[model samples]
Target: MRIGLYPGTFDPVTHGHLDIIGRATALVDRLVIGVAINRDKGPLFTLEERVEMIESEVAAIADRTGCEIVAHPFENLLIDCANDVGAKLIVRGLRAVADFEYEFQMVGMNRQLDNTIETVFLMAEAEHQAIASKLVKEIARLGGDVSKFVTPAVREALLARVGRA
Candidate 1:
């Protein structure tokens, strides 16, 4: 079985993320959405909350897709996490040239860490190409409506986090 690891902070899974996840599933037998517990990123939601929200958001279509997507939290090196879950491919989404540049560096580092795992890049859907988690958080923090960028569950979580809900 071809397993792919889609690793991200997923502080709050957005529509853009779901777009990537949806497309990545078509290329692998199983796609593991690894939520990284990175403190440097200053996530808005706790790991458990992120995992729960992602599970809720991905559950409906996870089984319908040719592949199954499992959401889980991991606090170790991404390569290690991928190995733990038996993933041979790492899924990444590219929204723009800037994203490509950033992901390019990480891809090199990941390859250096583990030559066994291959990295696959998927371009984000045109509709979601502009939606980013940082932008979503900033808008939510400034009391702007983030309903269109994120799922209803994620929007609720963001609103509650910023005390707007």
Candidate 2:
């Protein structure tokens, strides 16, 4: 089976992230959405909350696309998680040139860790090019409507995180 690993903090999965997941799902037999546990960056939502949000969003898409979404929390290296999940490919979303640069470095590092694991980059939908978790949080925190940038679950999660709703 062609299993792919899509790793990210996914603090609150944005529409852009979901878009990439949907597209990547078509190319792989199963996609594991690895939620990286980063001690350096303080997250807005708890790990459980983040997982719930991602699960709900992915579940909705899976209902329509027949894609399987598995959520795993990885504290070790991404390559290790990929190996554990038997993922030969690592899927990444490219939002802009800056994203390409950052993802490129990570891809190179992953290749160094395991030459057998290849990284695949998918561009975000044009409308969601500027949509990111941080930006979504910022907008929602300030009472701006983010209905177009995230799913209903994410929007509610963001509002709850910011103590707005």
Candidate 3:
């Protein structure tokens, strides 16, 4: 089975992230959404919260995708998680040149860690290209609406995280 791992902090899985997940599903028989644990970045949501958000967001189309979708937390090296999950490809979403540059470096490192697993990049659709988790949180923290960027559940989660909900 062809398995692809889409790894991210997914602090609050935005629409752009979900879009990439949907598209990534089309390229593999199974897509595993790997929620990375990065305490150094001080994510607003807990690991469990992030996993639940991705799970909730993806559930809408999981049944019709022709691909199995599962979200899990990864605490170790990403390549190790990919290997453990039997992922032959590491899926990444690039919003623009900046994203591509960073993702490119990571892809090179991932390849060095395990040459057998390849990295695939997906460009974000124009409408959702500017929506990022960091910006989403900032908007919510400042009492702005993030409904357009995230699912209803994730929007609520973000508000609650900042004691606004």
> Residue 111 in candidate 1 has what lDDT?
94
lDDT of 3 by residue, 1-165 (tens): 999999999988999998999999889999999999989989988888888888878987678787899997888999999999999899989898999989888888988989999999999999999998999999999999999999888888789989899
Can you tell me which runs of candidate 2 are displaced by over 4 Å?
Answer: none
User: Taking the tens digit of each residue's C-alpha lDDT, what string does model 1 give over 35-132?
Assistant: 99998898888889989988899887787785788887899999999999999999999999999999999889999999999999999999999998
lDDT (Cα, tens digit) per residue for candidate 2, span 74-139: 889999999999999999999899999988899889888899999999999899999988888889
Task: Give per-candidate clash totals.
Answer: 0, 0, 0
Which parts of model 1 have CA positions greater than 4 angstroms off? none
Error of 2 at 88 (Å): 0.5
Clashing pairs for predicted structure model 1, backbone only: none
lDDT of 2 at 44: 90
Name the better of 1 and 2 by TM-score: 2
The TM-score measured for candidate 2 stands at 0.96
75: Cα error in model 1, Å = 1.8
Give candidate 1's TM-score.
Answer: 0.95
Name the top lDDT candidate: 1
Clashing pairs for model 3 are: none
